[model samples]
Target chain A: MHPLVLQYDGDSEEKISKIMTEEIIIAGFGGQGVLSMGKILAYSAIMQDQEVSWMPSYGPEMRGGTANVTVILSSERISSPIINTFDTAIILNQQSLDKFENSVKPGGVLIYDGNGISRHPERRDINIYRIDAASEAAKLGSAKAVNMIVLGGYLKVKPLVELQNVVKGLAESLPQRHHSLIPMNEKAIKRGMEIVNTVHEVG
Target chain B: MKELKLMKGNEAIAEAAIRAGADAYFGYPITPQSEVLEYLMAERPHERTGMIVLQAESEIAAINMVYGGAACGRKVMTSSSSPGISLKQEGLSYIAGSELPCLVVNVVRGGPGLGTIQPAQSDYFQAVKGGGHGDYRLIVLAPASVQEMADFVDLGFELAFRYRNPAMILTDGALGQMMEKVWLKEPKPRMTEYPEWATTGKTPDRERNIITSLELDSGRQEKFNLKLQAKYREMEEKEVRYETIECEDAEYLLVAYGTSARICQKSVQVARENGIKVGLLRPMTLFPFPKKILREMAPKLKGILSVEMSTGQMVEDVMLAVNGLVEVEHYGRMGGIIPAPDEIVSVLEEKFIKQNYYG
Candidate 1:
């Protein structure tokens, strides 16, 4: 077993087990791993004995354009997997924020890249968390790994599943050689966790 | 036991097909309708309910795969948007000529060729009047909402087998992308009952029924054509469905379907707000064309304006249905351009205002 798999605490496990029934949405441009993020979240929920649904939005010209996905995790059977509004929205780009800001239910959490998104959203009713994950991941050598950094941001706001459990889910879901990439993700996750923890402490 | 939940029209159709005991689904991806395939892929009911789903190389393969599956007496369906659906015409016509039962869903997008991924109801004539060569007809169902999207799956499949012909759900991108509350029924737990006429392979007593369109003899081919026409007539009598909106004392009736109907609904509301007394008649089934209702309503109205996403495909149907009982005119936006309710209302005001008031 990898150290990343064991990094999750018992409290996170209890939290995940307690409220595994939740709907999550991850959205961004084509290369942002929006679909894979939904897949990982759905697979993790499935591993936790929850009913899961993952829907990816892709068209013929979706590449290099706007892309998004909806993931549903619930205790009971889900009827239709398409989510018109979301409880949690992870937006990685400005277009994702623009297209999805109105779609978040009031009081829902919105996690976005602070560096990538310049303008603050006009609406202040919903909970918004701006993460400079792109810069943080850039320090870790792979700017493309910003998705994992945002996943870190997701953990702080909606930590329904344990960080270690997510790592384990990724390990089980991804191929073998990809296992080497886990440590960087764990680092990114910790960086994300610190931001949320600081915000809570200050508030 | 009925319950309502908000759903997109595309997802509702997928859930409804699952509930209707659809045994197989084969399709290629296309916008406005991709959610149907995405839903089936995520649900994977094939593993639990003995269903099968295959993403084919193209729309041609998908429809042919459906024909192969339907020949085995299995309830199967395939869906595509405009351009992709045009590719399935050959297989659709062959299925019709062979009298096979299958369902084809066209969640229409704007098109002459990949014109745009926006909603359009331009395929009315292709769906109802037979897109391919032959004296044949497909039972076409046009759903206007998420709830109806789900309900029409069962209705389309039932009528497909009932008439031994292909049934089409003629929806548009708006219906495919919009969301609403949908009440889903529990899955039907039994195998679909097929008629003895269906081509089940290699059965001892049946002598391996040949499913083909090759009646070499001219008289035999004519006999098959007449038989098909008779079956279509029976379907027209039994399966025609339409909705009349506030036409009790209307002077002008707007004819529309699918996403166009939603726009027309708004137009009717706005026109009524202006005291225009303009009502709407939406044909849920396009093939049967709701000819009887239009004929009956024509005498009561001054004229009918056939409004659609296509330039004038459905206008012809409106003309045929009214059979010149009253004046008929057409208003449309084509090449994937969606006409707004206000635009349609302007056409109505322009066309009818002079005739009714000035005349």
Candidate 2:
């Protein structure tokens, strides 16, 4: 059995569950796995018996343009998937940073990859963290795992869902052929956790 | 029991259709709803249960194909977005006139013609008020969640067959595109037997069944119209489905369906937090419209507000249901726009709470 499968059974009833609602937006270029990152988070939330909604920006906007997704995870039943404001914004590029930085609610968190951001986040009311996810994934010898790295940085800060549940979620999201890459993705996540730097903390 | 899968609403509809023992799916591709066809084709349900999945060249052709399949007493379905659904209006009217049992899903986008591909409930009038020519009605099921998207396929089919009337899954682009954990039902085998009324190569021992809407005789056609009216009345009595949240103590009521209903649900929570006695009345079946509940609730509420993605289509129904027993107002975002929860709360405050509005 996978480690996550074991964790899934053990954590239920034995562990004290926290009830929190987090509305997050993941934004980047079209092929940067922004949607996938949101999907993975949503699936992880589901594994923890949390209610989640994942809404992606689709149609022509997905043709080599900015791609984004809104994910709301809650202990209670989620009301709506479409939200204008977000508790956290995981920005992958400068364009996404410019578009979504102001949309983050005050006293919330903003995590961004420093790869393409020319201007740092200017919000003083929210907590901001910068992670070199691209470099971390490149160092891990798997450039495609940038999303996993960013996701790791997210979990490190919020820790809304358990890491093992995320691994189970990854297994569910990825096809059977890509299951071999789970270990690499796990390493990328750990690297992300290690390298993330907090730029500002909310008081 | 099958484990829950994180699936898109459109994909859920496709999977649910197969599990509901749908015999065939003939649909054309459209934004926000193309996933329904794509998932069915990729899964090759044809091999899974001998269910025929065909990608028709056009929406018109798809609806005609559905008509053909339903005529032969097969469980058939088709899905499309707003403009594509418009193309099937003629076929929809004919199906209603002929009293065919089939499912038509309209994952609506913003449109008077070719509009934006985002979510909109602008097609409420089109769905409930008879878009095609002649007087007819479809059992319209509006899903607020991805789970309902999966569940309603079976329910829609059940209702369709029970009444021998066409049923529609009226959803918007947002609900179709959004993803959630869906607990899929066990697969049911494809329907092998149809009703005796089905025209499946009638034998010499039995009289041939002719499936059509062509009653040229004026008296007979009027009688058929009367029969349809009686059937609709029966449906209104039996098929009215809705959900009320915090309505028992509410002084203000929000009438909404589909995606707008989901947003209004959040608004209900927000309004309650602000010490406002607001509630949400979500109609699960739009055609039946939940008029009886609205009529009963109207006397106790200060006012009713109909929130929609379109420009006041369902508000008309709300007003008709309330029938001046309560003050009714409409707040809407048109042309692919969706109103936020706070926006709805503000609208509620400005329109109802502040004015101390009462009917």
lDDT of 1: 0.77
| Lowest-sum lDDT 10-residue window in model 1 chain B | B1-10
State which candidate has the highest TM-score.
2
lDDT of 2: 0.90
lDDT of 2 by residue, B1-359 (tens): 56599999999999999999999999999888999999999999988888999999899999999999999989999999999999999999999998999999999999888989988988989899888999999999998899999999999998999999999999988989999989999888887778889999979899999999999999999999999999999999888888887787889999898999889888887887799988888888999888998899899999899999988888988898889999999999988889999999999888877775564
* Tens digits of per-residue lDDT for model 1, B124-215: 87888899888889989888766779888988888888788999999987678755446787677537666676676566766667788678
- lDDT values, one for every candidate: 0.77, 0.90
Query: Candidate 2: which stretches are off by over 4 Å?
Result: A1-18, B356-359
Can you tell me the CAPRI class of model 2?
acceptable
Clashes in model 2: which pairs?
none
